[model samples]
Target: MVTSVLAGFAASAVLIVAIGAQNAFVLRQGLRREHVLAVVAICAVSDLVLILAGIGGLGAVVSARPGAVTAIRWIGAAFLVSYAIMAARRAARPSTLNPAERTPTTLGATLITCLALTYLNPHVYLDTVLLLGSIAQQHPHRWLFGIGAAAASLVWFAALGAGAHKLGPLLARPAAWRVLDGVIALVMLGVAVNLATG
Candidate 1:
């Protein structure tokens, strides 16, 4: 059972680690040092809610409605492609930030942005609630799996946000941002292509 729970958590983390808008936003905010804790907490909580909902039978309902998932897949693919373009554009003109501006401190604004990024992204529900939840349900003590998955989200968000802060100097460089954004664009484009093809 413990092994199953750990496997569920690992699987959940792998899925969530994709280069989507939310992860991009989190990394960017972390680099900017803007409301890291708030953003992390919001992401963690959102995942918790969605994972629980999925484990509690929402995944089954979603699976029953193939149309909804299909629609979301297309929409998400479009969003990812758009985001990729934006990142590629940014790569061309990376902006260097002042050290003073890179302090993650905005509370309300960060919370709102994190909320919008997490909730508005339909892919979050499809992946976290539907895919992860459904897979977890197959294990005994499904609740344990849910807990482990939720813990993964919390750990990931916190680590990504806080850890990026330590790399402020490197991230502040135009060259570094360009490289990062370029990588982001490629990852997102790959995901989009996979979505369209799959």
Candidate 2:
């Protein structure tokens, strides 16, 4: 059981530690000190839902429905492109970081964007659902593996959101925001292209 849990944790961390849209958003929220808890909750919860669904055998259902996945791919690619454009704009025009200007997005907007980022990414389904679910099924304690994966998601998002604040001093400058946004834009765009082609 312990070995299963450890394997799950390692697999989950490997999949999630990459710099993706969700991670980038969480880090930005942590840096801006804007609705960090809400952002973390949405991401962690979304992940938990997917992980549980995968373990519960939804991965098989998803695999059976290739059309659904294809539809999601196209739609997700479009969404990623739009986000890339937005990030590029932000990078081009570094926003002033006055207290009032810090949270340019309302809580509702931020939450929606967070959800979209989490759900619309095909990699999330492939990794958390198909990959993890398939791997969990190999273990005697599949449920324990799922639990461990979920715990890893919670810990990762919490650390990312909370630890980002520690870099607040560095992010105090507009130049830093521009650089960060530029990187985010490139990542989003590259992923979008990958989705569109694949």
lDDT of 2 at 162: 91
Task: Name the lDDT of candidate 2.
Answer: 0.88
Which portions of model 2 show Cα errors greater than 4 Å?
94-103
lDDT tens digits, residue span 58-113, model 1: 97888789887777777767867887897789777746754335445468766765
Each model's lDDT comes to 0.79, 0.88
lDDT of 2 by residue, 1-198 (tens): 998898888889999999888898898888788889999999888888898899999999999999999999888899999999998998898567633256467899999999999898898999999999999999999888988898899999999999998987777788888888899899999888988899
lDDT of 2 at 195: 88
